[model samples]
Target: MTARQHDTVGELLARSHRLGADPRNTNYAGGNTSAKGLAADPVTGQDTELLWVKGSGGDLGTLTGEGLAALRLDRLRALKGVYPGVGREDEMVAAFDHCLHGKGGAAPSIDTAMHGLLDAPHVDHLHPDSGIALACAADGEKLTRDCFGDSVVWVPWRRPGFQLGLDIAAVKEDNPGAVGCVLGGHGITAWGDSSDECERNSLHIIGTAARFLAERGRPEPFGPVLEGFGPLPRQERRERAAALAPLIRGLASADRPQIGHFDDSGAVLDFLSREEHQRLAALGTSCPDHFLRTKVSPLVLDLPAAAPLEEAEARLRELHEEYREGYRAYYERHAGPDSPPMRGADPAVVLVPGVGMFSFGKDKQTARVAGEFYLNAINVMHGAEAVSSYSPIPESEKFRIEYWELEEAKLRRMPPPRPLATRVALVTGAASGIGRAIAHRLSAEGACVVVADRNTQSAEEVAAELGGPDKAVAAAVDVTSEEEIAAAFRAAALAFGGVDLVVNNAGISLSRPLLETSADDWDTQHRIMARGSFLASREGARVMKAQGLGGDIVYIASKNGVFAGPDNIAYGAAKADQAHQVRLLAAELGELGIRVNGVNPDGVVRGSGIFAGGWGAQRAAVYGVPEEKLGEFYAQRTLLKREVLPEHVANAVFALTGGDLSHTTGLHIPVDAGVPAAFLR
Candidate 1:
C-alpha cells in the first residue's frame, strides 16, 4: 500500500472511532468493519506486509494501530479449510492445524479472507445505518443502479471465507479493472490506489444512502419515548411456547433423532411470536455474504392446510421438500461435475414463519452471518412488503449465483462495499401487530426503525423487543390531526435523517347500528380513521417531496372499503374515500415518483383500539358473543374460513411500495386470507 493510501485507512480508522457515541452507530457492533493494509509481500523477499484487520472487542474511536492485528495473505489463505467447530480453537492452534500467527491469535477478523481478495491497495468496510438501509433493501441492487448508476457492480451475497475470496478473483476477471464490489445485505467495501479515494468512496456511498434514507418518507421519527411496547401475551406465549419448544428444537436440530433442549434465553423469547415468529421470516439476514450461507431466502412460519403438530410438521416438511426440490433442480442445472461443491448451498435452514431463524451451517461464521443476513433479508422483505415486495436476484439469477463457480469465488474473495449500509427508517403505528411486525422487520433488515403509535408505552415496548435504543425507537402519534402528523414526520426526519416507508396503520374503528349512529359519531370516525390517514399521508408526501424523494405512501384500508359494510357504515365510508384518495394521490404523485396505494385487509383483529376496542365489541354484541370471537366472525364471513392478521395486511402493503411496484399505481391490494372472491381473489 502507498503512504497516501495507508494514511486514508488511518483516517477512516480514526473517524469510525468517532461513531461510538453517535446515535447512528446504534448496532454497529453487531455488524463488522475492516480495512486493507500497506504490506505487499516484498518482491525482494523483504516481507512486504499488506493488511491489518479489526481485532475483536475494539470500538471505533478506541481503535489505534495496535487495535488491528496483522496477518499475512498467504498465511491467511491457508486457514480456509481447517474446519471450524470440529475441536477447540486453541487445541487446533497447538496441534498446528493451520497458519496461526497473530501474535495473540485474535482470530483474524471474520471477513479477513474476503478482504484479501479485493486486490485493491486499500479498502474499508462498514455496516453503517445509512448504507445498510439500501443494501438491506429488497432488490437493493436495482435501487443502487437507480440511485448510484450502474457504475457499481453488485455481486449477490455469498459465504465470505474461501468462496468469496475465489469469487472476487473471478469477478475481477469478469469486470476487468473496476473500482470494487458490494455484498448485498452485508456491509460495503471501497478501495483505491489512494486511501483518500477509498475513504471518499466509503463515505460517499454511505452518505448517498444516508441522503436517500433521509429523503425516504418516514411517517414519524419519534425517539423511544414510549414507556412500553406491550409484552408478548405471556399466557398465550407460554401455551404456544410449550407447544412449540420441542417443535422448535426439532426444526432447528441438525440431528433430528436427538431431542435437544432449546436454550430459552431472553433473546430467543424476545423474538418469540404470537404470530408464531413468522416475524423471523421477515428478518432472515441483512448481509449479502449471508446469501450463500442462508441461500438467499429463509423459512416462513406457514402452517399447513391442517394443524395439530403432525399436520404442521407435514406442511413444514412440504416446504423443506420444495426447497430441496428447487435446490436439487438448481444444482442439477448449474452444477456439472466440473462445478465446485458448496456446503449449505441449498437454503437448508427454513424459517418456520412464526419461528426464529434456524441453521444448518458447518460452523459459526456460516451460521451467524447466515442468520444475520436472514434477519436483514426479513426486514427488507417486510419493509419492502410494506412498500412493495421482497424480490431479490431473479430466480434464474439466484440459481446462477447459488451455483456459479466464479461468483462463489468472488464472494469468498472480498466483502462488498456498503450499498445502503447505514440508513434509518421510521414507520408509524409500529406498535401492535402490523406496525410492530414491520418495525421488527425493518430493524432486522438493517434500518433503524422508529416504532410509532398513540400508545407511547406500546411503541417503546416494540422498540425494546427489537435490539435496543437507537436501533429501534418507539413513539406515539395520532395520525388524524394535521399538526400531529406534521410533527411526527418532522421528528422522524430529525431522528433517522429521513424516512423510507410511511406506513399508516393507525386509525380507530367503530361499528354501530346504522340508525343508532349519530352524525357526531360519524364525524368523529371520519376524523380519526379517514382524515387521520390523509393527514399522515399528506405530511409524509410533503417531506418526501421536499427531500426530492418519491417514496411510497401506504394506507391501510379495510376490505369493506372495496365494497361497503352496513354495520361499519362510517368506517366503510371513510375507508372507501381513503382508498379512492390513494388512487388519486398515486396519479398526482406519479410525477413526483411517490407511489401511493391502499391495502384492504379483512378479518384482522387484536391491534388497533379501533378494531379490538370498539369494532370488536360492537360486532360481538351483534353476534351475541364475546368480542374476542371477532376472528371467527370475520373468518366465517370469508370463503376461506381463515382469519388474516395485521401483518398479512402489512405484507400486501409491503409488496406494493418498492421498486417492484415501479410500474404499478392507483391499485388497492387486499390481504384478507383470500376474501372477497372477485375483488381480493
Candidate 2:
C-alpha cells in the first residue's frame, strides 16, 4: 500500500476505464489490461516484481484494485519452464494460483500469461471490432502489412492460452520495431515499455485498421438491402418486437429460463436488412469473447418483415428447432470424449427480419451485454466483408473455445443463483407501501422487477433504489385503465423477457357505510381494486401463457373481504371480488401451471397507501381511536397482537410465489397478524 505502488495500480485502473468506456476499444468484460510494477514483499520486506492484471470475469470499465489479480512476475515466468507444452496448456491456469503475490486479489484470467510473459512493462489484449475485422479477413496478414507496414505484426489464428502468449512474445522479439500484433482469428495485442505507450499503440492499430477498411473497402459488401427486409416504422417495430418477445423467450428458455434484451439499434436493423447478411452471420463471430456471450451465431428469421403474424410464429418455432439441432450437431462434431457436456442447445441471439435482435441470458445485464456483443460482431462482419470476405476462425476452433476446460472451471466457481434468479416480477402501485416493499423483496431475491404505478416519478425512484434498470424498471400505470395495464405488461416483457410474477397490490378505500356511500365512491373503489386486479391478471395470464413458462399471480385482498367489517361496504366488496378472483383464476390457470394466491391483511395503517390517502383517518373515526394508534387498535384485536407492516405482507407474497408454494395454489394467506375472523374456514 505504499504511495508509489498505489499510484501504479490507480493509473492502471484509470487506463483500463478509459479503454473500456468506448465500445470501439473493446467489449463488455472482453479484454484484459496489465501493468508490471514493484511492490514490497510481505515475506522478506524486499521489493518484488508484480503483475497487476484484470481478473477473470472482470470488466475493464468498472475495474477496481480488488478486481485486479496480483501475481509474482518471477514465479509466473518460472511456470513457463515447466509449462508441459501446448496440449497441457489448460493446466497452466491452475498453476497461476501458485504464483499469487500475497493471495491474489482476484482469480487470474485465461489470458494471464499473455501479460505476464510479455517483454514489456504494460500490455493490452483487446477485442476491438475494427482490429478483429482485419484479423478475421481472408487477407488479414497482407492487410496488416499494407496498413501498418511492419509496425504491427500478424500472428495466425491460435486459441488463447499459454502458447499464444509465448508466440506473441517471440514475435515481438523477432520484430524489434513492432508495437503490437494482430492475433489472426482472435484479436489484437499491444505492449510497450510504459502504460501510456501501450495504450497509444493499441489505439493506433485500431484506428489504422478502421481507416483501411473505410478507404479500400468495397461498396455494399453485404449487397443491396433486400426488398422485404427493411425496418418497420419505429412504433410498429417496437410493437411487433414486444408482441413476439414472450413467445421467442419461451422457446429460448426451453432448456433453462432466460432473461431477455431487445435491441433495435440502427446497426441491427441495417445488418438484418441486407441480402448477404445470413451468409455472413453463418460464418459466426471471430473473437472468442464475442461468441461466449452471443453464442456461435444468431437464429435469423427466414420470412419477410411483413409476414403474417401467425405464419411468423409458426416459422419461428421451426427455426428455433433447427437452430438447436444445428448447435447440437456442431458440438457433437468437435467435442472430445473428455470434453465437458454440452451446456445447452438454445440460441442466445435471435434476429427477426424487421423487429431487431433479441438476446437472452440468465439475467438482464448479461442478456443486454450479449446483444451488444452481437452488434459488435455485426460491425466486425461489415468491416471484414467490405475488403476481403468475412472470414472467421474455423468452427472447430470456436467449439474448443466455447467448451474450454478453463471456462468450465470458471462457471463451476460461480455462486449458485438466487431463488428468483431468472424470474421477472411486475408489482402495481410499487411506488410506495406494500407494493414497494414487495418490489424490493423480489429484487433482493434476484427477480427483475417492474415498478408499475400511477405515480411515474415515485415509481422511477423506487426502480432506481432497487438497483437501476438491470434490476428494476419503472412503468407509469393507472390500474383502472386497461390500456395502461396492458402497457405495463408489455413493459415487463420488453424489460426482462416476460413476467413470471404479478402482484395485484394496487388499491383504494372508501370507509363509508351503505347509507353514506355515494355511487361514485363505490364505483371508484370497485374500479381500482376489483376491476384493476382482473385486468392485470388477465394480461399477465396472456403473457405467461405465451411464454409457456408457468407463472404466479398474487392478489392483495383484505380482511374486510371475509370479516364483514362495519361501514366498509364499497372497499369490502372490491376485496371480496379480488379474493374470489384468486380462487377462480387459480382453478382456471392451474392447467397452465400458473399459480394464483391472495394475502388478506386486516389494516396496514402505518405504510398502506390506502391508509395514507384518507382511509386511516376515516377508519379511525369509525373505530373511536386516534389515527396514530390505529395500527395498535387493529393488532390488539388479532390473536398475535402484532402490527402488520408492508414488509410482512411482502414476505407473505414471497412465501406464496418464491417456490415453496409451488404446489399450493388458489390459497389465501392471512397477514393480519392473526385475524380469527379473516382466517379461511
Candidate 3:
C-alpha cells in the first residue's frame, strides 16, 4: 500500500504522542490509538489489513511502534459475531490473544474490538477532561448535539466489551457522515481515513465542549483564604500534607505500608474549596476509565481550622473507617452472586478541607499518577457542574468495568516491583548537598524517606518538593545531642513503622592549620562528626533490632579521613574517628543482620553548605585561585580529572545498601573521582 492509502507507522506514533502528551487529552495510560495498515501474511505471501492499537499499559504520550500491538483486522472483527455467546470476560481476552499477528507481543487494549469495528483507517480514543465533562453531563446527549450537531454520534453508556463495540459500530453505520462519537459517562472517539482528519475532529469536539462550558460561566473561584484564616503560604500547606501522610498511609495498609502523594495545585485547591465539593466528589468518577485507578468516590475529611494535630489525626482515622464501611456497602449493593472477590475497601484518593487532595499507592510513582488522574477528574467534574448537574455512568456499569477480569489482568501483567519497595530510609543533613541527593534517590527507588536536618525550614522544603509528605517527612535533629537524635529516630518509627536504612551525613568541615585551630574548633568538629555518628547509629540499631528487621547504616566520611590534608586537621581527624566507628558498629551489629558502611567523598562543592559557608574562599586562597575555580582545581587534582558530585556519593551509598552488597559490610567506598590516596587497602 502507498502512503496515500495508509498512514506510515511513524505517523501513527506521532498522532498517539500528540494526543497523549497533553493532560487535557489523557491521564496515566487511559487513552488508546490505532491505525489500520497492511501486514504481509507469512504463510499466504499476501498483504492483509492489520490493526495496530496502543498495547495495554502503554502511555500514549510516550508511545512508539513497539507500544502498538499488531492484530489481524479480519480476525479481530470476526470475533464480534462469536462474542455475543461469550459470557466470561477472560474468554474474550483469550480470544483476542488468538488473533495476534506475531508470535509474541503485548495484549491489545480492551477497546481493541471497538477500534476494529470502526471502518475508518485511523481511530483515536481519549478521555480528555473537556470531552468527559460533556459525556458526564445530565443532558449529555443534548449537549453533544448542540456542540457538534450531525458531525458526531452519541452512544449511551455500555460496559466496555464485545457488545459495546457492536453498539458503537451500529451508531457509526447509521451516521456514516459523522466524524466522531461521544460515549455517555465514558469518553470520546474520533475516526477518519487519515490521522490528520481524526486528530482534527477529536480536537474540534473537545474545544466545542470547553467553549460551551465557558459560555455557561464557571463556579466562583475558590480563594486560598479559609473561613477564619488568612491565606497560608505554600510551605505551610505542604506542612499540612506532610503531617497527614503517615496517618493516611497507616490506615491504607494493615500489613504492607503505602505511600501518599499530595497535590495542592490551584486546580485541586479550587475544587476542594467549593461548598459542594463533598457532594460532587461522592457522586463517583466522571468517567468509567478512572474507576480502576481512583475508585468510585474520594474519601472526604473536613479539617477544622486551627484544630490540634491530635484531633486531626483522630478525625482522619474515624473518617477512614467510615469510608471503608461505605465502600464495602457500595460493593455489596452492586455485586451479583457471581461477582469476583472484593479488591479491598481502602480509599485511593482523599479530600481534606484545607489541604487539597491526597492519593495513595504502593509506591511514589503510582501515587503521583493517582494524584494526576484525580486532578484531571476534578477538571472534568467541575466542567460538568459549571454547565449542568454532573452525572456519571451508573454504579452498575462502573462496577462491571472496575471488576472486569481483563482490567485486572493488565495490572497482573506489570513487571515485578523494584527492591526496597516498602522500606523506610532516614537521611540526616538532607536539607542540602549529598544527603538531599540520597533522599531523592532513595524515594525514586520506592523507599519512604525521612529528611532530617537541624535546619527545619530547609528540611521541610526538601520534603515538600519530593512529592509532599507521603514520600518523605522532615525532622529536626541536632545530631550532636543524644536527645535530639533519639527523638528523630522515634519520629521515623512513628512515621513509617520503623526505619530500614539510616544515612548518617550530618557534620561540619573545619579547615584550619594546627596552630590556627583553636581548642573550641577542635571540640566542635569532634562533637558533630564523631558524637553525632555514634548517637544516630546507636538509635538506628536499637530501632531495627527491636523490630527484628535487619537494616543498613551508612556514614558520609571524607577522603581527608584516609589521607590527611594540610590545614584540614580537625575535620580529617573527626572523619577518621567516624570511619573507625563504622567498623566497630558493624562488628557488633552484624549479629542482628544490620550492616554498617561509609562513603568517603571529596570536592562536592555545588550544593554543599560547607563550600557556601566561607570554606570555598579559604580553599581558593590556599590554592591561589579564584573561589569560582576551586571546584575545577579539585577536579584536576583527582586521578580521573572529574569533579566529585553529590549524586556520585549518593549512588555509592545506594550500592552499599542494595542487594549487590548484601554479604559486604564494614567497608568505606571512595567517591572522590578515583583518588589513589583514599583507596581502601
Count of residue pairs whose backbone atoms collide, per candidate: 97, 0, 0
Q: Relative to the true structure, how large is the alpha-carbon lDDT of every model? A: 0.55, 0.93, 0.80
For model 1, the stretches where C-alpha displacement exceeds 4 angstroms are 1-98, 101-425, 624-626, 677-681
Question: For candidate 1, lDDT tens digit of each residue in 1-681?
Answer: 457446745765665565434424323343334554444343454544445656544555466666665556555555555536422332322222143333523444445555655666566656555555555566667766655664455766654445555566566557654555556655565566665676566667667755655565252221121122223344443333334433333333322211111122233333333232444343344444345556655555465211365665566556655655655665677666856674432343444322233443332223443444444444344333332233344444455445655455545765542222233355667778667766665565445566778888988888889776546666668776666666565555433334546777766667787897889889987887778877877766665554444567777777878765557788788888888888788888889778877888874775654565567777777777778787877788777788887667655765675345677877788777666542843
TM-score of each: 0.44, 0.99, 0.74
For residues 351-451, could you state the per-residue lDDT of candidate 2 as single tens digits? Answer: 99888999999999999999999999999999999989888988988889999888898899989999999999999999999999999999999999999
lDDT of 3 at 204: 85
In candidate 3, residue 577 scores what lDDT? Answer: 97
Better of 1 and 2 by lDDT: 2
Ranking by TM-score: 2, 3, 1
